[model samples]
Target: MTAAVDVRARLVDRLEASGVLTPGWRQAFLDVGRHEFLPDVFWASTGDGYERCDRARSPERWLELAYSDVAIVTQWDDGTSSGQQREPTSSVSMPTMVASMLRDLDVHEGHKVWEGGTGPGWNAGLLARRQGAHNVVTVELDAVVAAQAAANFRALDIAPTAVVGDAAHGYLPGAPYDRGILTCSVRHVPPALIGQIRRHGVLVLPFAPLFGGGAVARLTVTGTTVTGTTATGPFTGSSAFMRMRQQRYQAPPVDDYLPGDWPGDAVREYTTLNPLNVVDDWLASFVVGLAVPDLYYRRSNNGGSGMTTLWLFDTGVTSWATVDFVDGASRFEVRQSGSRRMWSEVEDTVRWWTAAGRPGFERFGLTLEGGEHRAWLHQPANPLPSPRGQD
Candidate 1:
């Protein structure tokens, strides 16, 4: 326990240095024990995949991880397979990210907070500890995970109203919250959630596009259902959070797009722009995703050849493209089929972004209104170019 405390002190110091852990959140972070909410076993990232860590077998390591900045996956396959499959359905988020989102939240004293993803209830515990447990309400989709988190809250001597249900719908019983935050990432900000936050109320969440990449969004509820609820805000920084359970992407298999041999109906071509540069960078993915919301991608590597293939597809199932990337090649072979030319669209979007000056995530913002989302640069009026327009 002493070692855990010491470890937490270092983490708090690190976060404070990072400027995300402000004075308002420092005490709650210090008081609320993060490890108390964690399960006996959790999965830690190993770059390639996840490595299981069990407290019973390695008590010291588990304790270190609990206080570390890294996220710990607590459930896999929604706990059906007990993490044997490594699907990462739920987790206690990284300390840095938790603090960053809380910073983005900018909560005030006596403010009623509604949290969408309870996970292990650590974030809610911090909020409860700061604002008083009665003022914080957290909802979780997985009943088993919620049950465990409730137990952990009691164990920590902190109790925030924990509801077991889909967070996307939000818990309306505690409506008109002063501030709201969602632990999970969403391609679309739920209208139901927007309705829960009072007008001018701040809602911090992760706004991810279907293409790839995501960032933390700090939105202020601007309008409500009388006209249509709208939450407009800028992304705070880069983030890689697990998708909201109901919002996870169920991508169609490659076979569904190509029923026969390689490039069966795809028109073969070549281009100088190597997608290697685009996919390797997060900001690139975010920009391209904003331009092409329905797009998604996959990568296949050639064994020992230092060569790769980047596959692009649209959610509408109308198009597919692949760029064969070879080292030191002046131009790469490209193939496309169907109504839309995805590779060409990517090439044009990349060029446009370059022409306009490469803007990072901070320059981008999102507006969710009338059951639709429009990502823009700098402000709401200047929306990202349409993928079709890029053609």
Candidate 2:
């Protein structure tokens, strides 16, 4: 226990030095140590895939993982699989990310905070300590995970109202909260959460679009709308959090997209744009995703030859395009099909991005009004032209 405490102190100091752990959260972090909430058997994807670790079998190793900056997976396949398959469904996020989100939360005394996901209850425990347990309400989707978190909270001698249900819907009974935060990322901000926060109340969450790449955002509620910018200050960083249960993607049948005669009837064309340019950078993925919301992509290469194919698919199943790149060639060939000109859209988005000097995530923002969302640049008034517009 003494060793654990020393390790915790070391971690706090490390994160504080990184500027993510501010003075406001120092004591709360110390008071609500992570080891107490984490389960005895958890998974850590230290390398390629999820690997299980048992505290009883190797206390020293478990302690090292608990105190380290990496995220610790507590639940696998949402509690459906065991021993064989090891895909993480729930976890305690990295300490630095937790601290960064908390700092952006900017909670004050007497404020009520609604937490979206209660994985292991460590974050909720920190919140409870910072703002009396009664002031924190946490919601989790899985009943078993929620029960375990409840038990963990009791063991730690902190009590926060823990609900077992969909966090995307949020906790309505405890409405009119002063602040709200989500451990999980969302493609769309739920209307219930926007309605629950009082005017001027802040809501901090990770916003992940359907395509790829994501970042945390801090929005303020006003009237029937909420508007804010993606987090950009020093401590802020990128995220790949699990999607809200309701927002999880259910990809269409592979056969439907790619018939036995794949690329059949696709209109082939050529352009000077290099396919490698957009796929290599997260910022490029984000910008292209904003411009083309309904599209997702896959890339593959031909053996040994410096040639690759970029396959694009529409979430709506209405369009598909494949861009092929060959070595030492300034131009590329694109085969596109369906009602939407998917390749043309990609080309236009890339063109616009280059014209704008290739802006970063901080230059982007979102505004939600009555459940409708619109992505914009610099400010809400300067909205980005929707993909729905003709190429």
Candidate 3:
């Protein structure tokens, strides 16, 4: 136990020396003993001496990882308990990522803050410790995680209000917060979160676009509007956060979606890139999603040939379309007998990105209206006058 405490101290010391830890943040890191919140066994991906979790052989090792400046996987696949599987569905984020996000949030003392996605209450605890406990409120989508987080906070004697519900809607009961932080990665900025912030308040979250990719975006809210830019640094890492409940998932059959028989000269292939790298390039995909909202991609390998298949789910009706890009040009087809021109949407979005000089996400800003779930994108030179104009 003493060795574990020493190791934790060393990790905190390193973080502080790295200049990423502010004075208040350093104190918070020291105060919050992560071992108390984690289970007896947990995986460590740091590539340090320890890699796998073993409660019997090394209880001390597990406890050490819990306290170190690293994240612990707590859940896998919706409600699957950590003890059941190795596939991580949810985790307490890494200390550096957590600290970086808090720094981006820039929450000062005594400010009313609303936090979305309370994993293990570590971040909530940090907010309550910095701001008054009475001034912080956190929301979690899973009841079990919420209950565990509540207990974690209670153990520390920090009484921040922790609610179990979909954070996509934002906790409106505690309205007009000074700052809002979303720890989860979202395909789109939730309109409710924007509405929940007071004018001039700060909102920080990871925002990605459909089709693929995302980034940490920081926005400032003002009377029914928000404007902000993306942060640049090492990628914070990828998270499999549950999509907003409203963003339903549906996939059409492969036959209907595929283009006519492959061209004689077509050659299929595949490649892998870090998922974080994909999110960093979200601008390319956002342009694609806006133009082609129903796009989905699948990767496959058949020994000799490998390719990624693209499908378009038509929102206008029950039908969808398919496109295959083997050698270069895309071959299009339709499936499920529907009325919407899903193919047109995908092509149009691609054309828009091409015509816009392929501007990156840095050129775009997002604005959210308070008390409502609507978000708008703004360009420095050509601000989107209205959300209706996004199409």
Best by lDDT: 1
User: Predictions ranked by lDDT, top down?
Assistant: 1, 2, 3
What is each predicted model's overall lDDT from 0 to 1?
0.88, 0.83, 0.62
Tens digits of per-residue lDDT for model 1, 1-391? 5887888888898999989899988888888878888889888775656768999999999988888777799888877883258478889888989998998898888899999989889999999999999999999988888898999988888878889998888788899899999999998888888888999999999878877789999989998655578889999999998898788789988888889888798999999998889898888988888889888899999898988999999887878999999999999999999889999889878998998899889999998888888889999999888755344
Better of 2 and 3 by TM-score: 2
Clashing pairs in 3: 76-89, 191-373, 191-374, 195-370, 195-371, 213-279, 214-279, 226-367, 291-349
TM-scores, in order shown?
A: 0.94, 0.91, 0.72
Q: Per-residue lDDT tens digits of candidate 3, residues 106-126?
A: 878778999998887888887
User: What local lDDT does model 1 show for residue 235?
Assistant: 90
Q: What are the root-mean-square deviations of the candidates from the true structure over C-alphas?
A: 2.1, 3.2, 6.6
Candidate 2, superposed: residue stretches over 4 Å from native: 47-51, 225-236, 255-260, 300-308, 325-330, 387-391
- Model 2, position 276: C-alpha lDDT score: 78
C-alpha lDDT (0 to 100) for residue 284 of candidate 2: 76
lDDT of 2 by residue, 1-391 (tens): 6999999999999999999998989999888889998889987757666657899999999989898888888877778885655457889998988998898899999999999999889999999999999999999988898999999998988999999988877798998799999999888788777678888888889888777778887887756423432222111346768777788888887578768687787898998888777777777777777777778888899789878999888887877889989978989999988888787887888888789888777788877775667777777777777553344
338: Cα error in model 1, Å: 1.7
